[model samples]
Target chain A: MSTATQTMPSVERVVTPGKYTFGRIMPEALKYFIVITLAISYAFPLYWMISSALKDDPQVYRIPPVLVPNPAHWENFINAWKSDNFTLYTFNSVFRYAVPYTLFTLLSSSVVAYGFSRIRWPGRDKLFYLCIGTMLIPYTVTMVPLFIIFKHLRWVGTYLPMIVPALFGNAFFIFMLRQFFMTLPEELSEAARIDGASELGIFFRIILPLAKPALAVVALFAFMGTWNDYLGPLIYINKYTMYPLALGIQKLRAMMSQVGNAPLAYPYLMAVSTIAAAPIIIIFFFAQRTFIEGIALTGLKG
Target chain B: MAVATAKKWRLSKRETQNLITGLLFVSPWLLGFLLWTLYPLISSAYYSFTRYDLVRPPIWIGLDNFREIFTDDPRFWTVVYNTFYYVGISVPLGVVVAFLMASLLNTKLVLRSTFRAIFYIPSIVPAVCSAMVWLFIYNNQYGVINNLLRAAGQPIIPFLSSVEWAKPSLIVISLWAQGTAVVIFLAALQDVPRSLYEAATVDGANALHRFWHITIPMCSPIILYNLVMSLIGAFQTFLMPYLLTNGGPMASTEFYAMNLYRQAFEFFRMGKACALAWIMAIVVAILTAILFRTSGRWVFYGGGER
Candidate 1:
């Protein structure tokens, strides 16, 4: 039902071009022309990013800009990584965010989803509706007070402000996982229950193993949300040492421009930007199917 | 009380055990609801009425914060106007562009998945990277676009540096990151059954007719969903403008969320920020309700009770 990225050949692909007439041919030709043009245009910005990142300082400033760097300054990536201590920042993104956030969000959300979906206790549906209602509460409404709460906890500069939230499940992720959990036949879990298995055991042994794709959707989304989060860190973290990649990349730019006594180090900044974006890109390519299906599932089901 | 009502509250021993187990599994969310969700939601509303800076205890001034923003703040009005302007142009334009992109993608194009990926990659790229890339592209003098214009002996436009151009420049940046909407629309577009199109074609209906009558009716529900989500997202837009322009060029790009961020963080006007936050919440709620209410007219559910 959720083969959202299935690209079957449509009727038009096999159209017999019987006697090419102006009326018949123009629309098809025009359609292909428009599609190709848009595809290239969509891709040009990233191409520009990569090409500019490879160029040296001077080449970046040259008029009628270089499309591809002649001698690729591969060292710029190393320099950018070392510059402003991006090594620390990258590690911060991994340790402070991606790993813990994904794991906790998955663990908490899936268990909550199981409770909401599989359990037949009274008040479950009402509580589930209450949980979904929280999705409508704008982040703005919570942002100020959350900051206040974190500040009171003296967690303003710590990873806890960001990371700890994942320990409690998100409403949307719970909703998505619950939808997946509900689809499993009641008899499977019932059969487990009759065999003297606990609910948690049934969830761990039977439910979780089958919920990999949905869990991946929640996990990857959680990782990306943390990896790309700027405002939360921007508000809480003032010390440059604790900054994640998203916020640290800004510091990298400032540090580069100042160290060279130049206005802005365009190529180096682009290089850092490229490095910052690399992990998500690699992940996207590797789990291309899961990523597309996840998006399609959320979009359609949502 | 009736015996039925009393009995309903009382569960059998086994049923009570099941309830206890269910609550155990969901206790994390329940605890979060009280601390993170419920507490903040209430306090935020409460704080919107007071004059609180973190150092000092919150001094209550009922409705004064709201009054100050409404009656006195010119900057607040400007922020609202800038936000509406951005939303007005960007959201609808995004919908159209994404719909077009999706429709084109739904066609029998070569390298279709590659094209879809290309279209989608920009949206998934971190806002920091995408914003900085545009900063390079939109840089006034040394930026690529201006450089090209200079090389061609054409006039160079100040993109992010001019009042007239900054918001539009930000809007352009938003359009780049609208691939999520495109994917959503593409899914909806693909879901439109071929048989309906075939039936329409046999009836002598053209592409425009089928799109208007069939493709549209079938996809209207998804469109509304995407619209509401994008509207909420666009209303709270912060990262791009914050990173790219930093609400500069005479603060033409200071959107609602950015203004709220500054108020809370820069000025330490926590009370005022909460007021702004509440105002945003109300506006969003109203706007969403309006959309859902008015959606009955245009949002055709091919399935009944849609």
Candidate 2:
């Protein structure tokens, strides 16, 4: 399907190369112009963000708005970092949430997904459907009670509320990984079993090795979810010092009101946002292929 | 007879082993469902009927919370309206934008992947970061948007602060992240057979006709998927409004999820929040069911006759 669709345009190009007229050429040029213009408009905010982050107060508030900073004050980032105790917040974000959450979710969800995809047992299919059904239950239904549960356990105001839940597999990740695992040939695992391998041995040797791309997708998703999550950290973590980068940035903005320096703070806030957004942007560029594939698989299959 | 009985016993033992192994592998999710998902679901249902503040034990109040939400609280209706307004506008708008973007990008062009990446990059940016960037863009004093307006000799609109503009501003922000839907739509577009278009062209169908008949019909399933998913997402829009306007200059941007969050956490009205959660959940489920039911009229499956 893909190959046929892809080759169609090239074939048309070849057939009509010498026959190009104003009617045909004009629309082609127009298409490219529109696409490029739309792409620029789509990318403008990100460009503005990075450029504004590097601008000083005057540059940021310039009448026509400077497209780029003249001097490009690099100190805005330094000041932003220092102003909000963002260094410590970065550590809290990384260690307290993103890393642990990703690692635990990947490990646990993959294991559970392996069972759903590869294992044969009574009631497995029924139970798996039930698990999938939970995806329909909105998080609003879960949030308050879970908060009460954690509060009773004295886990609020700590990273435990965020970290502990991830240790148990998330339904979405489990579903995604299971779908990926199901696409792998069953004969491989069966062969491993005949070679005196236990189920765990087959999972470890045959399945996990072959599932690297899918695992990478799951890991990337977990990283983004943890890093980008605002509400979870907002509800659970009360201490300013314990804030993840998301909540920390929010707090920094709110605190800017107290400092009463909207001009200076605007650039600093933009600087902080740029810094916070850097990792995922870098990851997206590098892992573009896997990310798109993962998105397509989830959307189509789900 | 003895040998056959012994073999049967061994077969049963192996079946037991299979069950045990499967259970072991799936234990984590099962435990999580019980502790986190199922428990919370049931507890929330129970709490919805009670009057519980965080500081006190829940007092069973029957339908009072529901009654209050339905009849007494004017704020509740405003939030409901706000949420519906958001979902109604954003979901359709997002679907249209994403479909158009996907169609545009589907053509043979130079730097196609780069363009796709640029469109999709914003979707992956942390919502908090995106909200912060938008806050700067919508700044009335020196925002990028206002500056552009001023350059064009137009009045600067108060985006987040003004009641009329707040919801629309959020809708615009939601549309910015429609890249996920665009990518999905692109995948769907590529799956459309070239022969279908060829056949249409041979029948003297123009570009518009081909897009309307061939491309749109073929991509309907994905478009519906995007529609349903975005509907659910729009209903739950919290972080953007919460961070951007803090539910507003007069609660104009108070989405359903934001109201629930504030009720539970900020005001400590745990029981009322629980009730609100259940109501929102039902509304979502009903909306989703309605979409699915109506989709049969439009959605075209690959193997089926149109």
Candidate 3:
């Protein structure tokens, strides 16, 4: 067909399907049109959120729905922060919770994955299968019992329940890191072993450095997991003083919606949401592959 | 997962040392499985048969908790029905929306990555933030959707405030976060062989025909995967209803997890909550089993190896 078209352009024009021109272009155009509509609808809530955060409370409810705030009350962000302990929440989410959890999960899951992947031992396969099976157990099933156990240990009002689990590693991260470890050639570690590098030395000096990208993936996921986690904080953190951003934002709304606070603080609510969401949004933009790969890896669901 | 064996599975001296080292490395998982997973799982099940509060020891009560849940609690049934209603409509609808978005995304479009990023960014947003934004979006007097309706002279619909509209409204919120499934489906769509579509087109298949024939069948495994994941996630929908609706407007949005939270924490019906948890677990397991069993009929693996 290419040769014929090259030989005689006019014949090729005549042979081309006539019915597909308008039909094809219309669908192509319509496809994009539908895509734009879908994208707008998907993006509108987030856009509405940030835009409304810029609006005065009254402007949020204005007729015709302000697409952009003329004044752009940028102070709403700070006002929302000061209206509640959102700064405390932010600190808890990042410094207290997400950072520690990410570091611990990266180290713990990597160590476990190294065991499952690079080492040969009896009962290893069974244990790896057990790790996979643990993923199937829903969190709700454990919620009741874990709460009881934690309460017994007087951990209900503390961050221990949430943070302690990370030191043990997540099954999903373990499975993910193990898959990454399997792809590395055994020779890398074997050569290190031949050089009298201890097993821990090889893991720390060779494997960990080589697995930096996967570690970043795991670390980002671990951070986001706790950063976005609501149930964990809701269960463990009793005092409003200790609530992470996820739970704290909800409390901010509730406090703002209390009696005598007429004309709901829509701007404050959106402002809090935007503040809570900013880290995730920034992370998504910077490490988009982390989100994409994390989703694909956990596609089968836990 | 295979490991080369030495001396017909008997460990040599070096192998024994490796075993100790490997066990040390995996001790976190070993301890977690026992303390975190196995112990809690068994205790949770055990607690279901006992009437216990935080202050009191768990008193053995046999299947009375289960019996009450089945025969006495009317709200429990409502919660179950609400969960099924949400899961039934939300899961299938989520898959459709995700597939539609993914299919649209899979096409040749300029600025594709920006659009893909736009579509996917929502799924990563914290659930509480998503809930807060949707709460404001569904505000009857000022919500964007309601505002649009008002501008067009239509009566404003109370979203989270109405019984009839609340569950559907929450479902819409759920559909917003289907970006995970959307990206997954997009990846799967990219993997689908283009030659299959070309072959279908040569045989006079139109766009819809090619879609139903080539796309659906080719993407069946991914469709099944998204279906399962969406179902599980939907069944556990909590944070949205809790934050936005608080399972209000007549408990219309009181999903499984929300009710479980209420029983265990708010009411301190720990035994009853444990029972609810076990019941949900069994239902989820049964549903997942049924899905996988029936999947063989619909899910088409590439290379045709069943």
User: Which model scores highest in DockQ?
Assistant: 1
Q: Each candidate's iRMS in angstroms?
A: 2.2, 3.1, 7.5
Q: Which pairs of residues collide in candidate 3?
A: none
Q: What DockQ, on C-alphas, does every prediction get?
A: 0.60, 0.59, 0.43
Poorest stretch of ten by lDDT in candidate 3 chain B: B1-10
- Which stretches in model 3 have alpha-carbon errors above 4 Å? A1-20, A300-302, B1-9, B198-206, B303-306
Tell me how much of the true interface, by contacts, candidate 1 captures. Answer: 0.57
lDDT of 3 at B97: 87
Q: What would the per-residue lDDT of candidate 1 be over residues A197-296, giving only the tens digit for each residue?
A: 9999999999999998789888888898888888878888888788889888788666655676453377777888898888888899888777776777
- lDDT per residue for candidate 2 within A211-269, as digits (tens), equals 88888999999999888988888888889889889888888888887767765788888
Predicted structure 1, TM vs. truth: 0.95
Top candidate by lDDT = 2
Error of 2 at A46 (Å): 1.0
TM-score of each: 0.95, 0.94, 0.92
Task: Using TM-score, give the best candidate's number.
Answer: 1
lDDT of 1 at B110: 76
Task: Enumerate residue pairs that collide in model 2.
Answer: none
